[model samples]
Target: MVSTIDSPEYTEDTFISRLLTKVPTPAGEGFAPGDDAAIIELEGVRFLGCADGLIEGVHFDLGTCSPADAGWKSLAVNLSDIAAMGGTPTSALVVLEARLGEADGESAAQAAYEGLGECARSFGVVISGGDVVSADRLALSVTVLGELPAVGEALLRSGARPGDLVCVTGRLGEAAMALATAIPSGTDHPWAERLHRPVPRLEEGRAIAAAGGSAAIDISDGLLLDLSRLCCASGVGARLDTAAVPRPAAAEWQGSGAQRVAPEQLEKAALGGGDDYELCFTIREPLLTRLDELWPEYGADYCVIGEIFEGSGIEGPDGRLDPAGWDHVASGRRSLE
Candidate 1:
């Protein structure tokens, strides 16, 4: 199935049709694409494997984006998902589409690798192996491997229940605004750093795990779109508080190239903007209280943005989370970070 750019086929079948044609699923091996990480048994352990990529002009601009940040984001985004599943990342493989005539392969690759290595070192993950090849544009891909404990539940997009409180770690929309500018050239904005090099909330994931929470996903696809994903997976619906969703500092938006969006518009961007990499999850009201009690120890603010409702898709008290967020097929972007 040749999915056209105009068609923007966002359905699961569009991805499934392409995958099944390539690798036929057998017995219980369900290679569904939307899940954070693919489940494949290895050496009697359930291993989670995930891969992410970035391309020039899609995920980053060739002229503006830094090679180091590009490299770091390519892997850091994947690690975020691994953490969302309450798993500890152990290994990674990187592939680079070497860009010629613009940047030297050795220097460019080294800068990118250095950034990637920095994040990997922080996460205690190893760089195993990867391949380098020539391409017209800068393209980087990283595949991450992680292991989950043998017993108990793996945090998933599904499992959010009605009445469960929706909460998020860290703020949102800062990254979208960061991408709106020319980064690596430096920005006067204080919040800009959060966008260029987002820190994955590995500690928060561990905290949630230790506290016995369920139903979680990394907020790479904006709050609403990601919540839609969780709702779809769990066969439920969500209602979010419009006022509660976090917005970037007023000072950052001032004098920035980004459109002078209104407060609500900025809130919308925060809600729908992708690449925040924060954790969004649902937990029983009881557990929500427990997290509230313990989150002080973690030194982060987790806001109760909404609650699970019966139905499908996500909704804000005001309305549907307007305009939707980024979609690879629809937006002509390379892929969701």
Candidate 2:
């Protein structure tokens, strides 16, 4: 079943319904926050479009990051959205909002934009022009445009079925651990790089799409939260084994005895961590063996964590799994530390 949230000022359904009714998708699907990106078909060409933002206090702190890190992250998140849609990113429009008169200065702002441009070029994308706004705080908005060059159709959240196997690419919790460990272990730590510089799983996403994945979503929030969103979109349920989630080893992250984080904490971070930027997708039962045999070229490593079911909600080791982590509008965040 699709989930709904109601509040005094706004409701998710009312706003989404109004948008869908008033603004038709034409030949493509309409907007949904967690759908990753939208496909727009115009003049027989299908393009993927998505926008993501990062604010100074909410997403990052300037004290803990350089202007370059902020810029890289802004564009990186948007690119992850494109990857989730199973498309190849071609170009991007970047919006920068900054407090110009602040101590950071014009040089700092220029550095940030340069960082974004470098990231775009590295990922084989062109950085088109966008507006710059003067504000009290720093904010970056990135809109990426991509195309389905090889894929027959864009992978969507609503495409999941009851019998599909739920899979995730690469390891989880490293990003959350990066965040949790940085303060005590120092910013110079290797894990900190995972938190700051995230690689979008574009190749893996394209591979999944080409392999006929039933549904796909990037794990920008948490594995459990994003998985729940996918289940809700597909009107199905999932039974996940927390033990199956891939977590970073204690020795790998624990640089010293004093910096050691608990094993359960690491597992928690893997299951319900944010900003991993990995892809969580579902595949048909028949395709798993084939994918496993020819796995080298599909890009990053992946693992099967669960399966889609016929009902609503997600089941975890303890029972009902709460899809709570990295809420953008909500001030409180799930803390692994």
Candidate 3:
């Protein structure tokens, strides 16, 4: 007999909560499932581990994105998780599922590995062991491992407090625009690289942690939804200055190179678009001066967009901003954008 809890109507969040209840964390583990990565300690050293997967139809269109782009993104997304914890990525294991018999399958698989190798070299990460299997469509899963020297050094979503200033690194909305325009793989479109080959903000994450950031999360999902998760983790609320959000410049999306996006569309994209692997973090007011002094050394673009407060949810100038972002189950059922 099917229980009420097993109904198909459960949202992704509800399913995860129910699943966790059935499989509680081990007795002595250092961390649980809700955060960006799992933290574990061994011989006085703390480590972070996380996994992310990319599917051909859902994450990329094979006709639009090259195999190399897919490979780079598969690892980069996981690296963003490590970055969220303010840890340096040390190694990774990749699981590749290839359509071996297809005409371009072998070549695509080779190019994908080349891209993965290139990304690993750039980040100084070791390509650890993994498995490969034949499948109907391409899929890749990556597991990244990282380390922190001390127990309290790794940043956590639960660390944010009221009066903390919320900040983000780099400009947002380019990836969303790129997707909307359906720019080809090799095009010179300004937003194309952002969607195809995103740079994980590893150095910037470390800088934020070193400068005493209270909490941090990578913006793999939309800014508003991810910020809501951070606030919920910390048991606080947030107020955002919509004008302060750093959106992509109009010139970047305008002109003959790519489809011109109006200012209002850009604003919506920045607010709700996902796949921009930038870091969103919170710092106490007292440490703002220190962050200002240290941020430049890392060559990161950042801005203060909001602040934490004592409450239950996120609010913008017009009042509570809807918690809308890329939800796997919900998006599969309908369009979010």
User: Clashes in each model (backbone N, CA, C under 3 Å)?
Assistant: 0, 0, 0
> All models: lDDT?
0.73, 0.79, 0.82
Q: In model 2, state the lDDT of residue 310.
A: 98
Top candidate when judged by lDDT against the true structure: 3
Model 1 score (lDDT): 0.73
Model 1: worst 10 consecutive residues (lDDT sum): 328-337
- What TM-scores do the predictions have? 0.87, 0.88, 0.92
Check candidate 3 and list the clashing pairs. Answer: none
Q: Which segments of candidate 3 are over 4 A away from where they belong?
A: 1-10, 28-30, 149-152, 296-298, 333-337
* Candidate 2: RMSD to truth: 3.3
Locate the minimum summed-lDDT window of 10 residues in model 2. 4-13
Flag clash pairs in model 1: none
Error of 3 at 44 (Å): 5.0
